[model samples]
Structure formats: C-alpha cells, structure tokens
Target chain A: MTKYVIRRLLQMIPVLIGATFLIFAMVFALPGDPTANKCGERPCPAEYVKKFEEEHNLNDPLPIQYAKYMGKLAKGDFGTSFREIPVKDELSERYVVTAKLATIAILFETVLGIFAGVLAGIRKGKFIDNLVLLSTLFVISIPIFVIGYVAQFLLGVKWRIFPVTVNANATGLDSWWQLLLPGLVLGSVSVAYVARLTRTNLVENLRADYVRTAKAKGLTTSRTIGLHALRNSLIPVVTFIGADFGALLGGAIVTEQIFNIQGVGGYIFSGIHNRDGVVVVGAVTVLILVYLLVNLLVDILYGVLDPRISHD
Target chain B: MSTISTRRGNRAEAAAAPSKYQPQDGLLLEVDDLFVEFHTDDGVAKAINGVSFDLRQGETLAILGESGSGKSVTAQAIMGILDMPPAKIPAGQVRYCGHDLLTMPEDERRKTRGPEISMIFQDALSSLNPVFPVGWQIAEMFRKHRGLNKSESLDRAVRLMERVQIPAAKERVKAYPHQFSGGMRQRIMIAMAIALDPAVLIADEPTTALDVTVQAQIMSLLEELQQEREMGLILITHDLGVVADVADKIAVMYAGRIVERADVYDIYARPGHPYTRGLLDSIPRLDQKGQTLSAIGGLPPNLTKIPAGCAFNPRCRMADHVCRTDLPPLREVEPGRESACHFAEEVLRG
Candidate 1:
C-alpha cells in the first residue's frame, strides 16, 4: 500500500508537467501581443514595446518562452503580471479563499447528498425516493450561474438574508457566512450528481444478497443498511467525489464571478478573458495537481472500504 | 400465574409456587397452516399456501422441491427474514420452543433469530458480505448478539473456522470472502450460521452451489455438527439425491405445499404423492442410462392464479375429476407419514 501511494505520488509529476505544458502551449498559440494588450488603447511608442518584449522574453520562440517560464516556475516564481505584481503574491490569498469555498461546498454537498441518497435508496420506489430523484434531476438540468442568480435573488435581493456579493473585508465567521451563498450555488450541481450516484449504488447494494444475510443475522435495520450496504455503496460515490473535486475547483468560476468573490476561480476567469498567461496557466496547473492528489486519495480510500481491492 | 425466579440457586424464591414450565418432549420448531402471499402488480401470489411441517431436535427435516416451489420462502418465513410488502404471512404460526415467532415483537424475534434459530443460504458467495473478512463476519454474530469484545470474538471466529474445518484458520481469519474457494466460502457461511449454537439451523440449498464431493463433505459436516449440538436442522433443497443420507424425515414440496412427508426410507421406497413419485422417477439411475428420463408433465402453476383444487392435479397422470375439484389437505396416509393426495393410499400401496 505504501508503495502504491508512493507510485501514485510519483506519477503525479508527469501529469502536472503535461497539464502545465498543454496550457502553456495553448496560451503561446493565442494570436495577440501580450505587450500591446498591457499597453491598452494608449498609443505605445515602438521603444516601449521593444523594452517590454526584451524584459518579458516575448520576442523569443515559443519553445524558448516555455523553457523560460519553466525555469522561473522551478525557481518558485509564477512570473509577474503585465501590471508588475507577482502572480504568486496575487494567487496565494485567492487560492486560500477558493480552497475554503471548495471545501465548504464539497462538505455540504457530500453530507446532504449522501443523506438524501441513502434515504432514497432505502425507500426506493416510494414517494420520498421519487421526490429526491426528481429534485436531483431538476438541480442537474439547471446551470450553476442560473442557480447562483436565483439564490442571490431569493436570499439576498428579496429576503435580505445575505449580501449578494461576498464581503472581501470580512474576517472569520463573517467571511464564512458571506461565502455560503456562492458555495451553495457552486455545490448545487455536484450535490445532485453525488446524490444520484449515491442513490443508484446504494439501491443496488441494498438489494444485494449479503444485505439479506445481514438482516438474517439479526443486525438491526440501521446496522445492516449503514454498515453493510452503505459501505459497499460508497465505492462509486468515492470515485465521483474524486473525479468531481477537480471539476468543482475549476467550475467555481461562474459562482465566484456571480458573488464577486476574489478567489482563484475569479482570478483564473479574468486571466483567461484578459489573456494573462501566467495566472491562467499557474492556476490551471495547481487545480490539476489538486485533482490528481484527490483521485489518489480516493483510490486509497477504496482500498480501505473494500478489502478485496488490494493495492498490490 | 407468576413464578418466583431464582438465579445462582438463590433460596429466597425456593418456597414459591412450583414453576409453570414443564419439559415437553415434542417438536422443536413447527410451522402450522402457513400461508404466505406476495402482492404484485399482476395480483396476489400464493407462494406458500397452508404449508405445515415440524422439526425435532437432533433430526434433519429436508424440504425438497423444484425451483420456485416456495421451499426457500418457507424457510425465510420461519426465520422471519422474508421481505414484507411483497410478502405477507396472513395466516400462520411459526412456533419455536412453544413461542410463536411470527407474532413475537421484532426485538424478541431478533433475539431468537441469531442465537436461537439461524439460517445459511444457497449461494454462499453472494450471501457473505464481500467487503469484510470471513472471520470478521463470523465474529460479528458474537459481537452483536453475545456482546463479545473484538479480540475475544475474533478468537471465537478462528475456533469456528477451525470447527468448520477450514485450514490455517488462524491466518485465514483475515482473508476476505473472495479469497476463499466455493466450498470454503460455504464452510464460512456454515461457521457463521452455527456460531451462536442456535437451536435450529436452516440450510437453504447449502450444497447446491458446490461440487458433488464438496456437497457430500458439507452434508456430513452439517450432520456432525447436528449430532454435536443436537440442533434441529431444516435442509431445504430440490435435489433428491443429496438429502437421502442426511435427512431423517423428508417433506416433498410442490406448488408451495408439502405434497408428501415420510421417513427418508419411506419417501424413496414408496412415494405417496404423484409429484414425489415423479421426482423420484426423474432421478438418473445407472440401469436407466439408455432410456429417456421420465419428467413431470406441465409446468408448476403460476402462483398468482394457481389452478383451483389440487395444485398438482394438472401435472398428475392419475389426477381425476375429484382431484381437479377439491384441494386434498395433508392427511395421515400411514402410521408416521402424511400425504396430500386424493389417492394417497393407492399410491402408497403400490
């Protein structure tokens, strides 16, 4: 198992490198002048363009530019923005905010989704089961931005329950409460998917012959369903959680923008729109790394849940 | 009448009125007039209609029937494990040690389930929890029912594995169900079933999924265990050959009812019901190698709309107009045998 974990960790290096390279290549190919974009509509002198190109190595070949970026990245520098602020300094705080938001969103999604899913699975074919299934489908069909806007309107604009846009200056509890609306919007689709996946797997597990055996053993209803059926049902759910973690991080873009939260999602989104290569590629690389690590953790968790799944 | 109870031979209650309890020498488990029905979209399925049987301690009662004959359903009802809603026992009494289990509270019934009466299923592979180790599953019975601690229960689990004759049980206790072979997995199931030293152990087609040699081994192991524990054994199977040596009394089921029941010798020597006779004749014999095997005519009746009167009448060659019009309740055909057939005497005489 240790060897398996180590192997997975080592495997992440190539994946990260490949992901970064691909983003870099795409950014390199974009038909625009970074220096000119930075200069805005102000008529730039030819010397200023030359000085900007020289400093930023924009005149070099794409491969050489990529190597230079890698060199700076290896030295723990994410390169400076066109406005002269270091990308690392800009992303670090946003990264924490995004991390907290994703964490809370996923936690909410997992807890509520699993609870509803288990209920649906146990009461399969009943009214409650149908109700849960319909709601999940409804959630899945609607887009996140729409969910965000609707949530903002109902809870923020009309009810005045929460601020429509998160407070950037808030600290601790105030910050959490402010982030709640965006988190809910960001997590709505995931909750639906997780609930659906969990319901499907749990319903199947509940019907398994072993469940019958567990009942025959005189274990209480809760013990049989929670311990035996639920554990077996979690493998697929775990897989979904792992695969969706990456999506949640990347997909938080719209929700963050809607709520006006200055998180990595917003950082990356504006960077992509403004064609800020350093911020875009850096955030994407970090997100991919996080995704890879989550998947690895899920595989390890799978091994723990099912003894038959040995790492060897 | 309340009797003063004493524990550890406390003399304080010794002068109280004599205990109302008296030892009765009779059956350990009895299913009287059991009627189980399943309500489905089509209609109600009369799965087990008036099925009756009795099990004595240290004796093996085999309920034999073809697939879908409600043999397993009867066992499930006895164990109180059948899924309700689809299944409903509207009329029946499952009396265990003079206590009606069917009407008992769920908690009391649960108490009786693992510790008093346990069951092993046909497909051991699917019956055993896949994620847990075989020993841990066996130990779970001890932990939940007996309140044994983890380490002690694990020790008991190893002993049970060794008792069931699994090799290297100490080491294999950590092995998962998928790691074990089919025979070994069945052995584990048996180990779990007999863990609590239940008064009655229902083996539902326990050997059907195993090879012939392993089948014999499992039967003998059950026989040995029954002899040691003196527990009532209810072996539910469709195979006529497998139960011949192990079962003391046999109840041959057809269309969810016991068609004939007698000693193992009498069942083979003289079958009182046409269905039982047909089952015996269909068994492949060495002398009948070249001849076409005899088979019962027509399929078993649909449970939703079982044919009126005798369920076996349409399939019985000797079925008469009376057989088609009247359901023959199980009646004494011999001194110690019962048969549910209009012409049971004639069938038995031949």
Candidate 2:
C-alpha cells in the first residue's frame, strides 16, 4: 500500500505540470495588455511600460516567461500580482474560507443525501420513494445560481433565518453560521446527485443474491439492509462523494459570487477579469494539487471498501 | 411410509399446542400443497402450483427440474426468503417439526432460520457476500443467531472452514469470497448454511455453477455433512446424473408442478409420467453413441398462461383429447410412487 501511494504521488507530478502549463498558456493568450489598465484608464507611459516589461519579463517569449514562472514556483514563490500584492498571501486567506465552505457542503450532502437515499431505496415504488425522486429531480434541473439567489433572498433576507451574506471580518462560530447558507446553496445540486446515486446503488444491492443469503441466514431486515447491503451499496457512493469533495474545493464560482463569499472562486474570477496571470495560475495550481490528492484518497478508499480490489 | 402415520399423530397433538410441537418420527420438514405466484407486469405467473414434498432427517430429497420450473421457488418458500410483493404464497403450509412455519410470527420464524433451517443458493460467488471475508460470512450465522462475540465466532468460523476442507483455514479466514475457487466458494456457502447445525438445509441448485468434477466433490461433501449431522437435505438440481447416487427420493417438476415422484431407483428405472420419461430419455447414453439423443420438444409453458389441461401436454407425445381438456392431478400410480398423468398405467407399462 505504501508503494502504491508513492507511485500515485509520483504520477501526479506530470499531471500538475501539464495542467499548470495549459492554464498559463490560456491566461497569456487572453486579449488586453496587463500594463494598459494599470495606470488609470489611459495607456501607461512609454518609460513606465519599459520598466514594467523589463521587471516582469513581458518582452520575453511565452515559453521563456513560463519557464521563469515555473522556476520561482519550484521554490514556493507564487510571484506578485499586477497590483504588486503577493499571490500566496491572497490565496492563503481565501483558501481557508473555501475550505470551510467545501467541508460544510460535503457534510450536508453526505449526511442528508445518504439518509434520504436509504429511505427511498428501502421503500422503493412507494410514496416516500416517489417524493425523493421528484424532489431530487427538481433540485438537479435548476441551475445553482438560481437556487443560491433564491435561497439567499427567502431564507436569508425574507425569513431572517440566516445572515444575507458571509461576514468577511467574522471569525469562529459566527463565521461558520454565516457560511452555512452559502454552504447549503453550494451543496444543493450535489445532494441531489449523491442521493440519486445512493438510491440506485442501494436498490440494486438490496436485490443482490448476497442480500437474499443474508435474509436466509435469519438476519433481521435492519441488519440485512443496514450491514450486508448498505456496506456494498456505499462503495460507489463514497467514491462519488470523495470526487465531489475535490470538485467542491475547486470552488463554486456562481455560488461564491451570489453570496459574496471571499473564496477561491471569487479570487480566480477577479484574477481573470483583471487578466492577472500570476494569481490565476497560482490559485488554479493549488486547486489542481488538491484535486489530485482527493482523487488519490478516493482510489485508496476504493481498495478499503472492496477487498477484491488490491492496491498491489 | 409408517413414519407418515406417526407424523399425522404428531400433527394432531401439535394442533392442540402448536408452539410446543417438535419433530417426531424424523419428519424434519413438510411442504404441503404450496402454491407460489409471481405478480409481473404481464400478469400473475404461477411459479409453484400445489407443490408438496417432505424431508426426513438424514435423507436427501432431490427436486429435479429445468430452469423456471419452480424448484428454487419451493426452497425459497420453505426458507421464507421469497420477496413477498413479486412472489407470494397464495396458499401453503410449510410445517417444520409439525409447527406451521407459514402461520408462525415473523420474529419466531426468523429465529428458526440458521439454527432450525438454512439455505445455500446457486452461483456461490454471488451467494456469498463479496465484500466480507468467507469466514466472516460463516461467522455471521453464529454472531447473529447465537449471540457469540467476534473472537469466539471467528474461532468457530475457522473450525468450519477446516471442516469444509478449505486449505489453511487459519490463514485464509480473512480472505474474501472472490479469493476462493468455485468449488471452494460453494464449500464456504455450505459451511455457512450448516454453521448452526440446522435441521433442514435447502440447497437451491448448489452445484449448478460448478464444473463437472467440482460438482461431484460438492455433492459428496454435502452427502457427508448430511450423514454426519443427520440433517434433512433438500437438493434442488436439474442434473439427473448428480441426483441418482445422492438423493433418497426424487421429485420431478414440470411447469411448477410435481409431475412424478418416486424412490430414486424406481423413478430412474420406470418413469410413470411422460415428462419424466422425456427427461430420462434425454440423458446421453454411451451405449447408444451413434444414435440421435431424444429431447423433450417445445418449451415449458409460460406460467401466466399455462395450457388448459396438463402443463406438459403441449410437449408430451401421448397428449390426447383427455390430456388437453383436463388437468391431471398428482395421484398414486403405485405404492410409494405418484405420477400426474391420465395415462400413467400405459406410461408405466411402456
């Protein structure tokens, strides 16, 4: 297992390099000059442009520029944004908020989704099953932005159940409460997917021959479904949830934007708007690393869930 | 045959106090006039139509049938494991030890399972829970039924594995089901079924998924286990070759009904029903190597719309006006033998 994990970690290096390079190339290819909008609305003075180009290596070819950025990145220097603020400092602050949001979102989906799914699966073709199917369909069909805004307006503004937007200055429990609404909004679609995936898998496993054997063993319905059937059913659901956690960590752009949560999504969004290649590339690179780690974790978990799948 | 009278006497006493009844005269299980129907989208498919059989302690009763002939369904009904909505027992009495299992409370019936009655299914790989270790699956019978602790149950599980002839039981106790070969997996399944020393062990086509050589090994293992425990074994199978040596009595099913039933040797030598004769004839013989093998023509009737008379009438060579107009009831054609056919005497004579 240790050797397998080491192999997996080594495999991530090339993927990380390839992903960062593609993002760097795309950001460099975007229209508009980074130096143009820096000095008020007018074009920068010739002297200022020369100084900026020389310092930032803007006159160098794209490949050379990328190479220089990568050289700094290898030493943990994320470089400075166009406004001269360190991208690392910006990312560290924003990533914490995004991490909290993703954690809460994941918890909401895993707990509620699996609960509802097991209920629906056990009582398949009944009223509760139909209700779950219809509601999850409803949640899946609507876009996240609509759900976010609508939830913000009603649950936050109208009902006063939660605060309208997350307090940027708040800390500890107060900040968690503020993030809860956005978290729910962010997790709404995934909850639907998780519930559906769980329901389908659970229903199928309940009919499996092993389940019948469990019943024939004189196991009570609860023990049969809860232990024997549910253990196998949750394998695929866990993989989906783990991969979804990685995707969530990448940040929900529209959800973050609607709630004004200072997360990775908003950080990357503004970086693209300002065409600040350093911030964009830095944030995306960290997100890519997180995704790879989560995927690796999921694969490891797969071996644990199913003994037939050996890491060796 | 005298045990039947003793069983009836016990039944009368059992009716006076049902819960106090116990198996007397070696009557381990009695499935009486059981009828099973499956409610499908098309219609209700009559899977088992008034099927009845009995198992005695230390005796093996082989239920012989083709696929979809309700052999497995009969076993499921006895185990009380049939999925109720799709598969319902409209009318039946499954008496285990003179107590009516059909009328027993679910909790009480559940208690009887594993310790009183247990089943092993076809496709041992699928039957055993894939995620759990083979020993753990066997150990579960003890854990759930006997209230044994994890370590104690696991200790017993190892003993069972060794008893089933699994090599290196201690080392492979934690190995999963897929790690074992086909025959080994089936042995694990049998070990699980007999874990609590169940009085009645229903094997639903247990050797169907195994190779020929492995099939023989599994059968012998089952026979040895039955002899050791004096357990009533219900061997559900399609292979005539497998049943001849192992089964004490044979019940030949066609279209969800027992078409013929007799002592193993009697049925094989002189089949009293046309369907049974067809099945016996279809078995390949080395003596007639150059001759074309005879086969039962046509398919088993669709359960939703069985033939008006006898279910096997469409495929029977002797099917005539009387055969098409009236369903032949399973009746005694000879002492200790029953055949469901209007021309039973003629078939027997032939």
Chain B TM-score for the candidates in order: 0.93, 0.93
Clash number by candidate, in order: 0, 0
- How would the docking of model 1 be graded? medium
Residue pairs whose backbone atoms clash in candidate 2: none
Q: Candidate 1's residue-wise lDDT over B49-107, tens digit each? A: 89888887677999999987999999999999888988999998988878888988998
Best by TM-score: 2
lDDT of candidate 2 over B73-152, digit per residue (tens): 88898999989989988898999988999999999999888888999989999988999988888889878877888998
Worst 10 residues of 1 chain B by lDDT: B1-10
TM-score of 1: 0.94
lDDT, model 2? 0.90
- lDDT, each prediction: 0.86, 0.90
CA RMSD per model (angstroms): 4.4, 4.0
lDDT of 1 at A50: 86
